[model samples]
Target: MPVIDQLRDSLGWDVVLTDDADRDARSHDTWPVATVWAKLGRHPHRPDAVVRASSVEDVVTTLRIAAQTGTPVTAWGLGSSVTGQPLPVAGGIVLDLAGLVSEPVLDEIDRTVTVAAGVRGSDLESWLGERGLTLNHSPQSLGRSTVGGWIATRATGQFSSRYGGIEDLVVGYQVVLADGTVADLGQRPRAAMGPDLKQLFLGSEGTLGVVTRVTCKVFAHPEHRVVEAFTLPDVEAGLTAMRQISQCGLRPFLVRFYDRDEAAHAVPHEEISAPVLFLGHEGLTSVATAEHAAATAIVASLGGTSMGAAPVDAWLSRRYDFSTVENLLAEPGGYAETVEVANVWSRLAPMYAELKQTLAPLATEVLGHFSHVYDQGSSLYMILLGRADDDETALARLEEIWARAMKVVVAHDGEISHHHGGGLARQPWVRESLGTGYPVLQKLKDGLDPAGLLNPGKLGFGRR
Candidate 1:
């Protein structure tokens, strides 16, 4: 109470939100499991106060005050964390960074955009589009997520194959630590630096520090764009096609192989009777031509039937629509979620089968799609759907699905999560995912946040 009064008096009374309505609104993310907890009035992790930070100075001051008082601070963006990363489970300060955006500075010569962290993805994209430039970072949550949240979560975009993920796009960032110290990390295109310190905070899910500004690589709008679609017999066959394409050194701007259940939602046509593949290319005309041709040849050799461009075009048009999850969440007995994991090609097929088989009994619809491919491996994004007669049963089903999927991910040598980041939902598995390296994270927590005050319970770092 004293800290709240102090913060209100010191940081401006308007910035501190102690009203019940305000705290209740900032309490959760897109996580349905957490939503269920809220519905049951089990908000044990709700924040004591929600602070609307107006600038980097505001962020620094709040962290200092919270640190001085031994309180946990969770950085909040658009609150779109599907993994519950933004939830202030330890009940301290939820630093809402949604209002801290500043004017974006674009460098035509360097092809980079320097902006504050509060800029939402859509706003950035629109600004770039006006200048015939693009960041090519289009995640499903683009419309709601802030640039800082993407860096914090280590998220992947749909066009990652050509443009790379957020980690690859970010040249540098400014992070405010637990003690109110600001560090500017990575300034050049490439550096001979020993270790990129910015990476320590990326995907740290607010456990390390609060990111405030970033400089990222951007691109001129693509001159050529190509789209292609195919129907594969099964997920294994689809994975094979994708793996071959990636291994052959062809980088398509978009590559998605969806299982039947998932395919139906994308195309929803009777002709698409099996698993489907959506492929595309965008960049120099020659590069697009070469990559698209090579990918088509690889998939055709694997017995994939060409399905024309209608389905792929359809997917592109509505890729960011999250209506399914939203609609389900609105229902009394419906639940759905997308969980993703990564593994090498050697274990890719088996891991996919194991995860689906384990989740099959608990779900009404289990769909799988592979994206964000690498030379050695790819990430699998699985959509799980289920229903019950009531909220209690639906919540139990949702929790069970996440629990089972996590076990399969660990048992099969897959990372607990590929792009979702380790939030409250994945906190317990973070240690196992890190193994011998887990202690390193703990040490980082101890050294950087000695008071255990920054996003205290995430990534299995710091005590709750």
Candidate 2:
């Protein structure tokens, strides 16, 4: 029997799919290059089959068969990854884990929730909100992305300044290794035990194993909320204000500072002639008020003109709108992409300036904004849009742009990726970015996935 037939025999016929539509849909994720390929009706890496595993046993059986047959099995969430992490490059089996949904179990006393990997972020948040709770993790792709995808990519949310990224929110997970072994790790709040093994799969991009379920921290919905916006004379001043606020231990829950160009695009007002900064605070009424006041004082001291709550409110209203990038990518001969990188505060200003200057000639527009602030530094998103004469030229230009951006990032001693895990888009620089850590990753891959079948050729792992 063929592999698909065998999967059906073991896991049910409905669970196995070999249709062209299913294979095509799993070929590429939301990666810009992949988007371009999609626009041109091309799916270069479609899997030979798709297995919609609805239960852990289904996953175990599929992996066991794949391992026995020397087949590649790449896990799929909602295909929201922008880095091509879910592309079935090796063309064996695409395990569709989205069907593995489980009713979330909330631990009111522990302040955490155990949810299946297929749970959509927005759905989970809505479910928690009904009970006066929240996951407090809202990535831009929250509506479409899954909790498993979040864990796999090491995702961060907009409210990360106060609540932290997915890594901080995740308390434990249940995963299935490459050879059909199911491992449940990190069941406690904290442990002095061996290296938190759950971390190995946190950002592994499904190269190490498949994340089936997650137990993550949850917060009661904020009792009060405050939004503050400021006009900074320059990006440098805005960065300084953010650092001071963070270092002062005032958690705003949301901190976004846009460069001049991005500010104009974001605010879209002739009066918006300077960089814009937006801060938000939430908690008990009194606590939110106090933090808002303190953050306002810091911004004022830095010569930040108070723009009041209007701008921030405007942003909050449409925070999840991704049509700008989507529409641009859909257009013929058009290209758009966003790259996020981070470093220490001292190097951020120079790095930002150098990146903008270096990328000026390559694209029609290069805009940036800073968010996910920490005491040490923050992530900067470089948004670029350009056009070419044709699809082939556009794809080539995208590669060139990434190559140039990575060089500038390395020169500035900055991380190549902050939240967007190294899908194929960043594969070329993963080794350089990981440095000595690269070989350690290789060892881990070898030890766990000795057959080199799980998500082959991603994150500088297995085959390239």
TM-score of each: 0.98, 0.98
Structural RMSD, model 1: 1.2
Q: Which segments of candidate 2 are over 4 A away from where they belong?
A: none
lDDT of each: 0.87, 0.90
For candidate 2, the clash count comes to: 0
Residue-level lDDT tens digits of model 2 in 1-464: 37877898898878888889989999979999999998889988889999998888988999999988888999999998998999988899999988889899999999999989999989899999999998999898999899999989999999899989888899999999999899998847778888888788989999999999999999987889999788998888899999999999999998999998899877865467899998999999999999999998989998899877888888888989999888888888889889999988999989999999988887899999999999999999999988878878889888888999899998898999999988988988999988998899999999999989999989997652
> Considering every candidate listed, which one attains the maximal lDDT?
2
Give candidate 1's error at residue 443 in angstroms: 0.9
Error of 2 at 104 (Å): 1.3
State residue 419's C-alpha deviation in candidate 1, in Å.
0.4
**What's model 1's lDDT at 341?**
91
Residue clash pairs of candidate 2: none
